[model samples]
Target: MKATKRQYAYYTGMFMILVVALYGIFLLTGKSFIWEGDGLAQHYPILEKFYTWLHQGSLTGWSWDLGLGADKLTTFSYYVLGDPFSYLIAFFPKGRLELGYNLLILLRLYASGLAFLFFARQRSFKPASQLVGTLAYTFAGYSLYVSIRHPFFLLPMILFPLLAYGIDHVLSGKSWIPLAIFTGLALISN
Candidate 1:
């Protein structure tokens, strides 16, 4: 189904409302989204290191920070290096990483909704059904569970719908490139 501008606007607005409804309390109270466990002790620090590296324009070599020193790129590659969204951290100033971290989680969730919408639209789902499915997929229990505690996991969730759409394209006698590209992205995102 061809989506009109009005439908796009409606979907976008609805997505924002859903996000705000779910997370607005914390925002209003100025509470940190960091999960106090792995999020505070591990993820945020790793992300701060990544930000420092990016800000310094040097993402190579060893760092003593990782327990008596480790290869910077190699260590980070297991965490943020492969996720494309992690690169956005460079835009956040040094002191405001916590805010950036929280905002990025929201952005990732929104992107997940958009990915699901793209898949539903490609499959010709009705507009209302598309909206419902997008919202459900975006706000699913697993998605919410991982958003704060394991934000990188959202990368796979976001890519899964696109990968499914690419599979549809290939099965319908289209070029295999889309499937291949999506597969590569899904793999690299992890």
Candidate 2:
């Protein structure tokens, strides 16, 4: 029997919910904490400190957390401070940045799956094949670990598959708008 439009959308929603639930199994099992190497030990704290600085009507210009007031710009330089989404880090409380990061990572992983699924649909791949590819890409070892520490870094990855697909369309006589939009997003995200 053929599925109705609502059924298809319901299936998609269920699948996405499953994907997110499975990806965050560590949290469900109590095996996950927001203490990945540099993310926990250093950068997240600096971001929290920076958040406080912003609330005080100033940027993070000094580093009392480090030895005697060093340059904050040097530290901020290593981070993608200008990225619009990166600014969302400040919304998380000083103590809950790790939780915020974990949530962000999970959401990004799901987004990566959706992006890949969209790209595969553009190629007319079978639904099963697209699902397999999406699962492989989302749960790849490198993605799992790196994204845990650096969800911001993974932002560009959500667009990479779409970027390739967009460029492919442009080469194949399709509109260039997708290509331009994807490229612009990737550039701004990085």
Candidate 3:
């Protein structure tokens, strides 16, 4: 069931439109599943502390005392959870919170699209089948389950398909540029 190039292109385009629509609605409604008992609030301060570390490079270890007060990282593990995008957002003119969220959403979409393209290029499945498979991988029960319970994991999930596709292409004797670019993206996406 080999998928023609044109069919793959069409399905990929439609998926992009769907992703954009969903993301736009989420942004406009300012709706998030975040809740008070969610523990997200507890993490905010740790993120702020990491942001400080990204800039200062002096705030290492579990806890450190500043001149004014003592800071504790008792529950915070900076290495695993630190987001580099925090530093990138500081360059934005607008507020960091909104900008950072928007950036994350955009990156998610781009990664999904790249993954779809890679799926289409596989050439083993029909174009329609490839589209359905990619979308299933992107929005299926597992994805939905993760999105609800451990949403932050979505970033790496979005990235996984693209990285797999890029690797597949490189293995199939395609150009190195796509693989190289995706490798760089995977590295910087941390």
Candidate 4:
């Protein structure tokens, strides 16, 4: 039991160290690792539109911001602007949107790492090997690239491992709560 605790502590410490290093490297250089490409540039405008709606004492009415005021249903049907967690961005002040967004990316990346770690451990991989795989999986080229190019798509990727794990456990006679929670999160996240 003690050894497992020690192992988890080590894994957590290593993961956090990597997080700080990566963030520091990009942030201190006046650049961003996760927001560099089309994702932030493209999505921020839409997110701000949602924010504007919230502050206007409206959630989902016709948007006057569109061409001669198209229906707000366009935002819901065509874009991730309807995602529940997207409202989390509105909590940030206008000037701090970048900070909030980058933080969300970082949090998702670390959560992805932890999910991979859980999956590997469940498959009976050794602890050290699990940590290595977790780090590699989280920071792999595909994830980094997609996070910048297609962040809306990346939301599913983050929850996939966890959702599967939760379902597997439920199937194996464990409680169903975890599975239900992850499923809701996956469906509503984006």
**Which is the leading candidate under lDDT?**
1
What is the TM-score of each predicted model, taking all chains together?
Answer: 0.95, 0.72, 0.54, 0.76
Q: What is the lDDT of residue 51 in candidate 3?
A: 57
Candidate 4: where is the Cα deviation over 4 Å? 1-9, 20-25, 33-37, 73-85, 170-177
lDDT of 4 at 3: 64
Candidate 1 lDDT score at position 30:
83
RMSD for each model, in Å, please?
1.6, 4.0, 6.1, 3.2
RMSD to native, candidate 2? 4.0
The digit string of per-residue lDDT tens for model 1 on 1-190 reads: 4556656677789988987899888889989888999998988898898898888887999888789899988888878999888899899888889989998899999899888888888877788988888889999999999998898889888898999999999899999998899899888877
How high is the CA lDDT of each candidate model? 0.87, 0.68, 0.55, 0.70
TM-score rank order: 1, 4, 2, 3
| Deviation (Å) of 145 in candidate 4 | 0.7
Candidate ranking (lDDT, best to worst): 1, 4, 2, 3
Top candidate on TM-score is 1
lDDT per residue for candidate 2 within 118-165, as digits (tens), equals: 786677676667677777777677777666676666666688898988
Q: In model 2, which range of ten residues has the least summed lDDT?
A: 2-11
Ranked by lDDT, the better of candidates 3 and 4 is 4
lDDT of 4 by residue, 33-130 (tens): 44545655667666667667767767666766676887775655445553545667768898887776676666667667777777677777777887
Candidate 3 lDDT for residue 69: 53
Q: lDDT by residue for model 3 over 115-166, one digit each (tens)?
A: 6657555667765677677766666565555443444556676667667777
